[model samples]
Target: MKTNSLLLYSCLLTMAACAGKNNVPATETINALNLKKGKTIFCGPADKQLGAVSFKISGNGKVQEDFNMALAMLHSFEYDEAEKAFADVIRKEPGCAMAYWGVAMSNFHPLWSPPSKEEFDKGVKAVAIAKSIGKKSKKETAYIDAIGAFYDVNAKDHRARCINFEKAMEKLHLDYPDDQDAATFYALALNSAADPADKTHAKQRKAGELLAKLGFDKSFHPGVIHYIIHSYDYPELAERALPAARKYASVAPSSAHAQHMPSHIFVRLGLWDESIYSNTIAADAARCYAENAGIKGHWDEELHSLDYLVYSYLQKADNKRAKQLCDYLNTIREVHPVTPKVLYSFAAIPARYVLENRMWKEAAVLEAHAAGNDWKKFPWENAIIHFTRLLGAVNLNQLDAARTELKTLTALHDELIQKQEAYKANQVQIQVKASEAWILFKEGKHEEALKQMNLAATMEESTPKPPVTPGEVAPARELLGDMLLAMNRPAEALEAYASNLKDRPNRFNALYNAGLAAERSNNAGKAADYYRRLLASSNAPGADRPELTAARLFLEKQKTLAVR
Candidate 1:
């Protein structure tokens, strides 16, 4: 993992050169030099086969080796490395059309953020170079055409060009049924196009079905397993990809994304232990990569992994791990300034620790602006910190502090909306209303508070969930249940908690509150059932939750009385 800023820039500019609309060198000389039709190539390293794909390229020796290596890296979403490798191929064989395609495709970064204008321009230049190389085989021509669709400068929108590229590949795959790379990439396009808001996830389902038909031996292809998990990222679909999720880490043991990717399914399925394991590996990989590469900032993979790691630890009531993670997050900035992704994790870790542990006092007095935490860079993430602060303030009957935090949340909501982050904006607004509801409840406006909280919960339910964060600060309806219980409305509270469980299953806090509500309502059977479920799922130590003790004693007393 060598850090070469100069090489990175050269890769980008050189890649762009291939996309440029300029004179191309004669292709006759290059084409006459090498002619390789098709061969079955093993992906990944020789000792550890990922799978076999029948690929054809017009190159031999080092050119062929580097090209295949570039493809494997691209399949794993190692864009920077792929770009550099492809650039090296260009140096070896300037006329290799598919090598130019590699460079162009690497610039596209299909699974991550859309490419910048310069990247698109460079990709277009690279495609132009491939075309200028002269007469190409039909197979080479199809590959060039697919990437050309991506770099088609006439197509202004990047996503539209991406769709066009996918459509082109669809035809190529249909034409050449044996090309697994084309089929796998086409599946990736479908998964990328799937709308998160559409709960049906029709596109994702189609992608998964396509991968399944390919007879994707999980051990054989990283993309097959990687895309399967991605296609089924949502909670409803997560269980369907459990086998793929479980196997992905082993398939691409060195990939940071591969290490972290399993947790998407794990978190969705509430498999806390598995999630912890996946994230721990991911974080270690990220840390080592950053150190070895001489990368300064907090690595994106580490931050993403830590967010999931913290959430899983909190769920399991591993207070020791949670505290250590929080401390690590606080000190991470000493190494380098936080990126936007790191900022989210830094804010979220503390918020999760205080709120999840029910340490209202710590949350109430938490420093709003920690050193190296740039609120201006990421107001949306800052909203999470404020949300927990507001929660604590409301719980502690600190109306002034609650009001101030609510005001700050409102400002963040406006900023997010202005930035066109509508989903995050809506999320912030929901938190704002939740805080307002809490404030109203403290002011003795019980009816108003319930009405407000109900409205907030409804809005949150209808809105599409945020993709970046591990989870919401807390579900509004669950908060509503807590408030209802505080007001002695146990029956209503129990209903609220139950409603929350329908959408967000296996959440420990909601189950605990629901049990308390049932107990207060004198429904011993329902109380016992809820408590038993909580205890079964809960990893909280004995001294951590007295409610557990109360539930146990009550059940034991009931058993004794029944015996009598």
Candidate 2:
């Protein structure tokens, strides 16, 4: 009789929690239901997928339905529906952790959303209660999984957001050990947290070394060195990246990700032998992987493996292998649909091949196919599609298409006005402007190009510099300097770089580019000083280090080729 009475009381509390229409907490900034579907479905476009609801959700009934609906709406980005759904969740379970996570997600996703302090606070509050309740007594079954997902975001703000994501992945990896997303997410998180400052910090160095045991190191990916080199404070410490780079190559000899990274790094470091050696290994390993995997893989796997194999061959100028690979690619793609990466890879080879050949029309078609045609099949490489359209259109002299791409990017930039990245938007603007400037240059309109470059400078200037890991400031500054140098205004370029380098003295690109600017101005003393500094620095990006050596050699021959 007592047990029955206790159960009845518990049921009453649950009933009370779900009783009302106005069940949501008032604190969230965005509507939970609206966010659930990401968009509102008007009466006309309503379909079966829109109406589907989860069978697993059996709760204080309506509230559970509301939560699922809200989660779907929010996931879909239909903020209005999500708002109502979350309100229902709150109504059903006033202290439901997922309701708060819903609010948090609606506010805090990386690309599209922005967080409100109120939503963050509410999420933190709910998560706190969730941790204690879910971990201890299994209070609510439906909310636990959602609670765990939101826990991936850190409370301390001490590590990169990726680090928190990695913690979440650890749980997921434990549950679904074979899922590649877990591995990719974990790799990305580690890649994200590693800053150039890590080069200086003993702890980061040890952590980097320890990561080798897990098959991740600087040579495995450029980001490994990039995070450390760019964020490194002691400009000198950036050299530490090399040891890990070598280690990464040797340890993971067969991994596609591992083979080429060391070579890429070596090329940047002007270590020609090492670069070639690593590139060869990467090329061979990829070839082997594709051949081995071909028999077992379905359409997608075969496509993926083939793409990697062809990419390595193309990079090495093995036209025979490239042709063979392309033939195989065409054969496989015709029979079976490949992933977005495969499409992008296929489009990219010809896009780059004719990049110098000026077959904009062919490239445009390939780019469009790669970017679009998703209705008949799954969408592949959505971002790459947009980027390829811009690149290929511009390459093929389809200014109209490139212009359209730029306009869309601008609109996107405007949409993200307050939420623009640390420096990426500025870089994008710089790229668009540089492209415009280059087209003008190609048309023998140096003055127009210079004007376009100046416009780029203005756009780049308007954006604020973000506090990031060491050496990250180079691209913007380099673009600025390159433009100024192109204008033959070495003094201004020098001043521009000086301003940035003063703040991020560890960034060696500034030093190297600064050397080039000095050389252009017939400032021999300054050029030598820059070259010497470049040679002395280890943190220089792999892409630019050869340019640095070239700059030094050019300086030596300056007297011979007097530009009258």
Candidate 3:
């Protein structure tokens, strides 16, 4: 049956491409490929243009029904809920081998946090239990084997194990050509194994293409859409993901993360208004969920939403709303005990508020010792707090204080390295270098300062900024622009700001500073253009930005002078 279906689909594809249309409708194709469990079938649609994969399983009615529910949650990355649903299936049919597979799969979060030793052991034990059931289908055995590879304690490297699991899934997908879930998970595993530093993003793009075949048919599948968004998250590919990003929240409106996910593309595209709407809805929903669960402090979901919301507000010069969010975050510390996760957001809120608003004076005055409890436990989170303080000291010419903060950042970087957190260690190292460049400029070392700043910028360009924040504390090139302006080099400063804007677009400080730089360089027309864009982005009411007032006055004067 599977072989025949493939031949039929290949003919249809040839006909569609050569003749401009396949006489068979997509609905008919789906109907033809809907084979029962015992029959082999094609994994994905034979017609590449048609984006649906409908694979079904047959078993005891109640157990099969519950297993389907668990699978849906697993596809969407909802591990906790999936675990419960799969456990219910095991309870209903203790001998069901695939139910144990579901439990093991739920225990692994491919990209975010690696499973703990205990989690890996539990998943391995589950696979062992599934093997003991003896009545498992070939497809079930394939899944069990793939998870066994994932928990291979001897492999030691988590990423290498993930790649092994991906390879296993690829073979399973090919062997069971009719299993849509296998194909879907294979694409997900491809992304899980992708290295973000790879500029080609080869695996991510492949994952996106494979998932794209599911198109409108599986539009309601949260994992299909969610994975699509993640696959094309880079600035270069963000345009390609606009459709999926727009549709995901509506597809999974009940999901807090889903509501927030689209904003990733929105932020990349500089669609401030869309980002604002998405995060607002997400934050509200997350708050409701936290209250219902009797959780005092914000959970991970709520913190994620609030972080994005505050960022969007600052981007649009909605300082009032941003301040309100900061106030809300303050309440979080008062209500809940400090966990590492909550501490991350608690540190981020204040840092974002000051930095995004360009409140350099406030940052300068911020006390480093006021850092949240157990700050040392999470050096990566504490680094952001210290970064802002470093920037503030530089801006105020508090050289000694800035040097002290830079030492703190170095300490944090070394600590992260010792803990095997390579990515964050490098991020903090970049901060330290950028601060050093600032100090060089303060010392009137012009040539040395620019060289250090450029080197810092190059290092920054080598890696993408972590997505957890709306923007960097101070983009390296943007700091270079600040140094250029300090040296009375307006034209050169404008060019530097423009370069930074290419990667981090529509940023408030960059936009406003660009305008200032333009005006100082005697380019009235370009200066006016920059100010207009800045004003357009400033949609918040009662926003107290003096720069906003300056831009308004400058633009108005330009208009009056033009009338002369």
Candidate 4:
């Protein structure tokens, strides 16, 4: 019943550790610790390496069935079984590594949708586990290290692998000098361990020093050059990084990791003007690569590049280009099947589209695409996507669906409680939550709507301080705008919406609500202006088609009011 039953088979390590053995049988035994609902079972975190499992599993046990089932599902990748299993795992072991990893590896992954604090905590716990599991012997340590590497592939626990790799590098280089691929592995480990800025600059410096010392670039690893770009005081190094980046990009243009480098470098160097060019090249390269790269790996980089293209165009203030990129992203869902990443991207379209003219119908269609499906495909994003979908339901006056969404909200909150993750809603999720509240407000359930709004605001206020991304502020302001608009306080909503737009004008949530806030305020001229702007925005490319039809209709009705 243990969430993280480490079940270290140390006694059997003698047989399995032999380098002569190619395959290690699943340790012959798994020890079970009886856990029950409401009993606080401490599965020791890696920090707590009581050499025990983890204490953060919380005292509750309802989620045991859920976590176990999810493990089985992941072993099979049976989407439905994986979804159910993951949901239960999170419900049972909210703070355990298994829950986060299970959900991440599930048919429906949390990070794929609207990520929750719960999943992040579980991820953190998983990382802690990797760090804490102190192995006594060489073989035991290697096996533990291997398992840790296995868990770190997911983004949430991704940083953990970096740590483990760095440790491995230290051991191989300093402890056992004869290890194979030590330098390459060491450099790779540093790339993950180095502070982004420090890593980049240091690599360039090291490359230069190595060239000077050895009379050539003896460190021939490609990634060393990739990390050196503009992160530190190495102009020569960064210049070198570009070609290295270009070379890798050329060879594996479809690799999301490869393509992400050069564009990110250019963007970080304050080269906005060149971003569109870079983004396009990388996106196209990635797409081409993905298409031709055989059948095994999924096309993560191509989709990521498409997203970057959308953002790049917006930064250049090129609405047309942004729209084109968004359209491409939209079509990906239709072309690809249902992975968590694909599905969440599918839902994000409506969230952004709402900012355009007003395609209540179009938005509904996108939301419906995810309806009754295994939203569990995206655990991290469940909160965001569900909240956004609920907004579409409210916009179309599907009160029943709106209520159903609230139940989902409750379940998600319960999950968060289990994980005890800090809460501060991302800008987009807040807007969606507020949008749903506005719908509730319109249904004459003013108090209920206020409670919903309050919950969102509370999350914003109470969320733990994490490093804010540059565009992170947009979601909260937009949500406040919707809440104010619903309260018949358009003037306040106008200010909130304006602030949100000014911070991230490309955000669809803010753009869509700008017109609504104006209309309710009876500022006919301002309303028309917002609608026109909405039509021109890039977040939702479909705006020209029918998104603004409703806003246009309203403007026509208000034409005579220009008498003011």
Instruction: Identify the leading candidate in terms of lDDT.
Output: 1
Clashes of 1: 9
Over the stretch 17-105, how does candidate 3's per-residue lDDT look in tens digits? 34223211233322232211211111122321112224343355667656776676676565666677676766566566677677778
Flag regions of model 3 displaced more than 4 Å.
Answer: 1-55, 216-218, 334-341, 365-373
- lDDT per residue for candidate 2 within 25-133, as digits (tens), equals 3333223223333232222122413222242332345566666555544433334345555655655565454565555445443222233444444444444333333
Tens-digit per-residue lDDT, 1-564, candidate 1: 013323433454454355433323444322322321222222223453333333567755557766776676677776666677676776677767787788778888775656765566566656656766654578888888888887665565656777888788788888877777777888887766555467688878888888887765544577888888888877678788999989877777656677888888888777888888998988887787677656675566687789899888877667778788888777664334254566677778888889977899999877643654557868877888888888998888889999999999999999998987776788889998898899999999999999999999998877655545667768898999999999999999999999887766667788888988998999988888888877766665533666667767878987998899
| TM-score of model number 3 | 0.86
Task: State the TM-score for model 2.
Answer: 0.41
Query: lDDT by residue for model 4 over 1-564, one digit each (tens)?
Result: 112212232222332344113221222211111111221111112221111011122225566544443433232223333444454453433333344334333322311222234443333333333233232235324423533452343433444545565666555545544432333334444444444324234543543343233211333323333333322223223334444444434333323344455665443333444445665665565455445534243355455455445544543445566566666554543333344445444444334444333445544434434231476544434555566556667778887876776567656655654554323224334544665566768688777876777666645533321211113322555666766776788887888787655434434456557777877777767777777776555333432444356667877777755566
lDDT of each: 0.74, 0.45, 0.73, 0.45
Question: Candidate 4: what lDDT?
Answer: 0.45
Off by over 4 Å in 1: 1-54, 116-121, 147-162, 217-219, 334-338, 368-373, 540-543
In order of lDDT, best first, we have: 1, 3, 2, 4
lDDT of 3 at 247: 87
lDDT of 4 at 67: 48
Worst 10 residues of 1 by lDDT: 33-42
Question: By the lDDT metric, which is better: model 2 or model 3?
Answer: 3
Residue 535 lDDT, candidate 1, scale 0-100: 70
TM-score of each: 0.85, 0.41, 0.86, 0.47
